[model samples]
Target: MKFGVQYYPEHWPRDRWAVDAKMMQRAGVNVVRMGEFAWSAYEPKEGALDFTWMEEAIALLSSHGIRTILCTCSRTPPPWLYQKHPGIVNCALNGNTQPTDERYRVGLAHGEFIAEAQRIDGAVIRHFAGNKHIVGWQVDNEIGASNDCFCPRCREKFQEHLRQKYSTPGALNEAWGSHFWSYNIEDFSEVPTPHKRAQPLVEYRRFMSGLNVEFSRWRADLIRELDPGKLVTTNYQNIHAQHTDCHALGRTVDVNGMNHYPARTPELAIDYYRGARGEVWCLEQHTRLQHHDTPAGRMRLWAWMAIAHGATGIVYFRWRQCRWGQEQFGDGLLPHSGEENRFYGDLSRIGAEIKHLGDMLAPTRPRAKAAIVFSYESRWSFEASGFDRGLGPVTEAVDFHKALSRRLTAIDAMDPRENLSAYRLVIAPRLWMVDQRIADNLRSFVGQGGTLCLTTASGVVDEYSKSFDTPRPGRLQDLAGVTVSDLAFDKALRLPLASDVIPDLDGEEGSLLADEVHPTGATVIATHAAGWRKGSPAITMHTVGKGRVVYVGVRLSPEAVQTLTNWLCETTGFPKPFELPNGVSACERACDDYTLLFFINYRDDPQNVQVGEGWIDAFTGESVAVAEVPANDLRILRSGK
Candidate 1:
């Protein structure tokens, strides 16, 4: 596997390059990612160039046998570019243009913005195209921003995108339910951003996701045009709120990369990697000591967790801690003094292990028995407009996904094009925006002996932002075998599973969104505990064709959700959980000749697992008489005999 680290050349003096490179080689770090936010230094003027410093840094790293992944530095446009072309500035829904203070303040669709990005990307690739040391290129850094664009250029492009999708103004009006307020439009340009008060969520969400996808395509195209051989990717922050669809973005890139902060649990690191489809590179791994009572081996544990989930590379955000800067990120392998720290020792140990593992930890795609249907459009819609309640289905969906990730072998957030037939169980959590075709597909999956799990606040809206006039569950009501009579927007209630199928389900409160369910032809598995709608079905199951469809009417805690998800996985005959201690994680992938298992011990204390005879530990080149692990360690075990 190739190991790389993200670094800022401008932050460290040129003189320190040799020292840093040497240290990296000693630690077995091979690749270094450079220049994501170096626009100011790269292009000082509108049509000027500066590569003297970057060239030297690249050369110094190459001489040390380290490869480089050059970034286009388009994430933050240079102040000169933004000042010269004010049109590139992103305008929020409130009619406010972003200030120069923030990094991602430029609109993606602005013509000048696209032109400037292309120029910079072309220049960087052309300069280093022949350089053997350059391995890949990162297109941008976290493309999606939270706010909606209300600028005239974005507004126009959004209308055009909508027109191409919906076809006519009348069709658009009908889909968005514009007649509710006698708000009918004659042209596409009449469409407006849904405000906090206005509830035209479906259209707004579709527009936002569409915009992001277009931007991703634009950036990927620019980079590919310059260097086709160099793998191109954009780092994605693993959060639902950012509205960046990594799954959709993954289709545009050669490889997938994600930034993770796994302070919550070691399991979260594994989950994030699985979500990104397992071909991942960690852009940022926190490795510093902080005030919070974070566990002692937390960093090591999370790092190993990532490796187990198919990380071909391991890299930290900062090699040296920052002394004075706006970021001043405290986490680094090396302390601010440029001396070896405790974290550095741990990193070196892990790096040595990876080097020893060598080909054993090569890129191995996951073999998933389950799939999760995640839609960027659905997330966009929920954030755009909805019942103004504190707890909503969107938040619940993200929570449920995190919960499911803890137990599943491979859990992927997938687009519609992905094959669902291979999955024994398919889950669609909080899929609010369900068109007829998608609804039909899910029904077919269940009909064809595949388990289907659908959660609450689903099938509420259509593609056009209009609620289904019939009932709450809308298009999926019949397939779910339940008719949602009315939705209690933000009501709180507790419900427990009647059957002792899974442990610990007593008095778990369901908040955010709840519905009054009236089962049409489904078996009631659970009921609500309070309110006038008490005793109403909260969980229902229906046998469809040779399979089954389970509908959850309310959200549950992470633990409770995991219990249910595990039950489904077990029922479908998925693989057993990997054998590892609490702080240790393991993931396995099998090829034609060999089966590789990634084992990571993420604890301060050493962890020991009894591996059956005939498996060799790839890291230490040791033939294990009995399986055991050391503190803060990672290993890959390959078996071919």
Candidate 2:
């Protein structure tokens, strides 16, 4: 595994370079990701490119055994470029042009903007192509972070995209069901930017997602062309960022990278990124609080959490916090004074431990028997439809995942369209947009003996973001063995629900939304205990082939949902290999030769847990049958086969 930090050489003086290099060497830092936001430093003026300073810095770092992961530096274009092409600024959905002063404001769909970005990107790649110390390339710093442009160029491109997708305006109109409001168009160009209409908004969402993928693909291809041997990657933000489809973006890179801020983002964000690819890198890991101080050992704990979820490379966000700029207060391993702090000690300890365990942990990947399926399209479609303001798909998915995480190891939170045959159990929460392909995929997965669990608000829409005329869940009614007869979505309405299959939540009240399910041949596992819709099926189970499908028709309490998730896990016969106490989690990454375990204590109090025999603590190199995990700390262990 690679242990590194993000270093901004341009931010400091030349004399400080060697000092940072020596400090990194002592801390077991092997890599430094640089130049992501340094376009202005590289090209101070138009056509006045300078690579000598960067080359010197790279050479200095290489001398200290620290390699570089150079970034293309196209995301934040220099001020001169923006001044030269002011038209590159993005236009927001409300018809206001975003100022070009902000980072990542270049319109991706703008042809001239692309040409300029490619020019600077190509220059950077060609300049550093032969640099031996550079291991890989980060295409851009979080592609599509601020690239959502609703300008005329984007509208034209969107129209062109729709034309290519439907081949005719009439077909597009029919697919979008635009005739309902007499909104049918005679030409694709007549379609405006995403507005009040559900179909156009969802389609535009998908189109923007595609544009992000295409943008990354272009950069990755350019990198490969310049240096075919080097790996290409781009940093992805939290999973809920709907501008880009991460799974699609991952296909364009050699490896997926993510920015991990445990305080702001959930732990499952790492899993989602890993699921986007197979293994991932923590490209920008928070080492301290923005303004406040991080509790001791918390940074190390978060790093281990990432590794536990299959992070092959862990890079702290920055070596030192910036003294000036927008991120002046964003703390790092070292304080603004460039002095050693608790974060430095924590980082050095983790780095040394990683250096010792790198070989054993490198080959091992996360293997999970169960998965939680997530879809951006489903989320986009549902959000566009404005069914419920509080219905957050990512939050709901995370709730189920957290429940499963208490008992399971390495539960994959991935896209629903990914291969599912390997998983024994799969939970898809709020799968609102179910198309023929999605429906068939779930049917096939369940048919092949995989237990599938789907939650409420599923199967409401088809591929075009249009509601189906048939019963709810659309094409999945037969597979689910139930149809939603009436949806009770009133804020004051709550169902007193009971379940025999999951008896732990019996007599529990469920609210937010409830689908009164009429089971055809399926078994009513749960029903409303007391309500206007009393005795109605709130949860049902159907045995399709060798497998079964469990349908949850209402949003239950977090505790109740957990009980149901645990019931599903038990039903699938998933092995509970690690028996961990509450507030402690054991994540396993195994290879043929050995199994690596990361024990994380999430509470303020110490946690004492018994480890299985033949396990050795990776940090202390001691054989132990019992381990005491400290508060907000982590322990890594390995066992030979």
Candidate 3:
């Protein structure tokens, strides 16, 4: 329930600290995140280290009842440190990248960078370890974002990782399947750089992602060792980014945190970042992205949307726009002139509403009976193969999530290896890379009477980026009950489903891929309607021990996906949440005492919903029968207990 802004006392003059504090206090901001990117300001010289000014800023905010979410500023080391030490920054295959002013230019596995980061971060932790006003410790500023270092040291570390996984060159070549084209290596040191081959490229990506997690965990473990009581987390970039696996990062930290920008992000990103643990802080909630003037009242609506998806905190990126940095045009609550605008008014209203409703909303989170499984390995495999150009795994996953959310408001988007026993209908979209564990997980879910749906381009390869010598879908071929005779490459097929089975999906347009599925002891649900592919199976389903599995042979549009979701719900008798009109969202969060509903209108016109009885406005305590939400606005209602 923390609400605040990211403040930088070092970025501004010393005299304006009290004014910002007063303004934040008036707006009901209970927290301010600072000191994330101010490494040089703290230690301008090698022997000269000063923290008295930061202490003063903290005290000023604490006097106004504002706490701090201090970040360990290791993402960007002081420029002097880079100048003093050479070969600490990242280097591409060509040469070392310049401009040390940018953040995360250093390699993760570099010894020099790791040593200096630990030194500086350990000092920061000890300095404010006992500060009562400091509520949490953010480990780093979005680990693995804008990070794709391929330096010699990093490459050596990757080679070491490969060496550990496979003891010798023969084992490495066997797993990578690089015997063709005479790419064999005599030793681990002889392994070439990882861009040309699929398996090597995928392994490289896996190595780098693990390195990012390792670096973050180093800081996280350091925080716990030094300061044990406070929560520790690093802000995750948008879920669509394939660099760092959020699932692993979520498990490593105490609570998950995300950088949420609603203008360009989908609702699935918010729910996904709020991982299975269901505790997330929007560490960098967007007010206005660069050059994109968000519509009026949308800021408050976006904040509510985050809360609706189980974000426990909302901290805007900045209180005021920077006047002179690279992001000078970035928008915030107050303009660069330090004057309040419409966005500030929106923030003021939101703060008051949260002040009234945060406690009631704090204990509640989104509960789901439907889930979608995502795999980072599959995304990397897709990237390495280079065939998934127009429709990637992320696109299909996001589209499927949006469709599922239309029918079920609280659908869980999870990793491939997480627990699937909680969901009745689980959808796996374009699971192109299937490992043994993932296959076993899906089998267990379906064997226990949970209905599973898998889309096209699924199970094309095994864990090591090698095509399965057996039938497609690798290990799950029996569970899925279908064999792919041929898969069309990047074809846009026409689907004509059985009208008696699901009438709504008759005129479906399937795109991206088409698989010619031959059912074995299963029923064909749909077929291609056009010439040259007429009567070919486009979708198939089978009943396996007490459950059903559906295989979609082509990519479905969002509307068609929704139709398929509704048909699944009807066929399996899965309990679905109450529905709302298009462009209107109603997400429910409940406890034993009462149930709270967050209503958001994303369209230009207002939306109205009828509650049968016994609903009161959570903010005003007034009984409401029909909730009226204006254009780009939101409402909160509490059910009578």
Candidate 4:
């Protein structure tokens, strides 16, 4: 696997590049990601550009036998460019223009801004594209803005987008459900982002995602035009809910990369990685002492967990910790003194381990048997409005999905259009907003010998962000073999309220979004604790054409959900979770004639494990009846002849 670090040229002196690169090479690091926020250094003026500094930096790394992944350096616009072209500043939805304080503050729709970015991008690519030591290019650092742009250019573009989508103002009005408050429009320009309580929030949310997707596509095209041969990607924030369509974004890039921080548990990071397809990399990993908590295992454990989840490349955010800059972010392998620190020791150990594994993990990919439907549009719409005026179903469902994914072999978030027939189980947890065609496709899947699992608050809204007129749980009610009488709002219930039932509580009682069920030849598996409708069902199951559909009505704790899911997984023929020590994780991948098993132990304690017949350790190159794995270690076992 490729190991690297993301470096800021300004933070370290140009003279130190050669020494840093050599140290990294000695430590088993093979790649370096350069220049995400160096726009000011590269472009000192409007049309004039400079590559002298970058050329020296690249050559220094090449001399050390380290590969470089050059960035376009457009994420943070040069201060001079923003000053000259004020229109490039992004305008917020609240009618406020973003000030020149933070990075990534440029308006994506500004034509002149894009033209200058393209110019600088072409120059950078032309300089480094032919370098033998350069392996790839990163298009943009983190290409997302929190605020929706309300600039004139963005407004005009949104109108054109709506016209292309709806074809007419009447159709747009009907789709957006804009007739509630005597709102009528004759032109696309009449559409405005919902600010207060006046408009349907769902429509505005959809528009934000669509606009971001278009911007991402535009940025990807610019980079591809410059250099198509080298691998290209943009860093994504894993588990972030704002930019929902990352799977769609992944399609536009050569590799999928993520910046992950797992404050809760290592499993959360693994779960998020499993949700994306293609080769994955941790572009920015944390490693330093903290004021709040002790550095987690000196950073080695974190790196191992990422590798366990199939990270092809691992890179830290900094080569040298900053002492007098905004990046005093408390996480660097090297301290400000640039001496070998404790964290550096941890990194060196992990790097040695990777070298030992060598080709075994370098070209391997994760194999799985399950898929989860995760859509940015659906999640944003569900969070837009309506749900007892508090946290919505989508938020709760994401937590639940992450919990369940922790136990599975490989979990991926996929668009419904992606072929899911290969997966033994397909789950749509609280899919509130769905297109009609996709809904029909899901229904057809269950009809044709596929197992589907859905949850409450699903199918309640249609493609245009409008609620169905018939009843709650709209188009999927029939397919789910249940009907809704009323949405039981603000209801909290305890799981396994009866004896002989395992309560689904992590620690406390959880809330349910909606409650109603009229089964049609379906079995009621569980029910609510108490209410006027005390005996109402909370879980149901129905057998369709050649498969079955399971509907969970309320949120359950991870333990409870796993209990139920384990049963289903066994029934559907998914591989059983291999029993391992506390910090040990094992996963298997197979080729036509061979099977490779990855065994990773993230703990500091040694472990003794049985070596099944026909397997040999890839790292130690030893054949034995049984073996003991050392502390903080990883092993790959290939099938023996």
Report the number of the highest-TM-score candidate: 2
RMSD, candidate 1, Å: 3.4
Candidate 3 lDDT over residue span 320-410, tens digit each: 9988767788757788888778888888888898898878987888887788887888888877887754466678778878777666657
Error of 3 at 105 (Å): 0.9
Query: Between which residue pairs do clashes occur in model 2?
Result: 459-473
Specify the poorest-scoring 10-residue window by lDDT in model 1: 264-273
Candidate order (lDDT) = 2, 3, 1, 4
Per-residue CA lDDT of model 2 for 1-641, tens digit only, reads: 87899999998999999999999999999999998998889899988999888999999999999999999887788888888988888888887988776788888888788898889888888889978999999978888898888989889999999999999988998898887878889998899887888899988988888988998898899889888899888899777688889889999999989999988887788888898355998999889777675678889888989999999989999999888877887757788889888888988898888888888788999988888897888888888997753585787888888888877878888888888888889889889899888888899999899999988888999989998999987899999998987766778877777777678878677888888788887899988888567777889999988999999999878888878887887777876546678879888898888888888998999887787689888767788687778888877887843
Give each model's clash number: 2, 1, 0, 1
Name the lDDT of candidate 3. 0.83
lDDT of 4 by residue, 182-213 (tens): 66789988876566432345555556556555
Query: Top model by lDDT, which number?
Result: 2
lDDT of each: 0.69, 0.86, 0.83, 0.68
Q: How accurate is candidate 1 locally (lDDT)?
A: 0.69
lDDT per residue for candidate 1 within 420-494, as digits (tens), equals 777778788788777777887887788789988888888877765467788867888888888887665554344
- In candidate 4, position 70 carries an lDDT of 83
In candidate 3, the residue pairs with backbone N, CA or C atoms under 3 Å apart (3 or more residues apart, or in different chains) clash, namely none
Ranking by TM-score: 2, 3, 4, 1
What's the CA error at residue 233 for candidate 3, in Å?
1.0
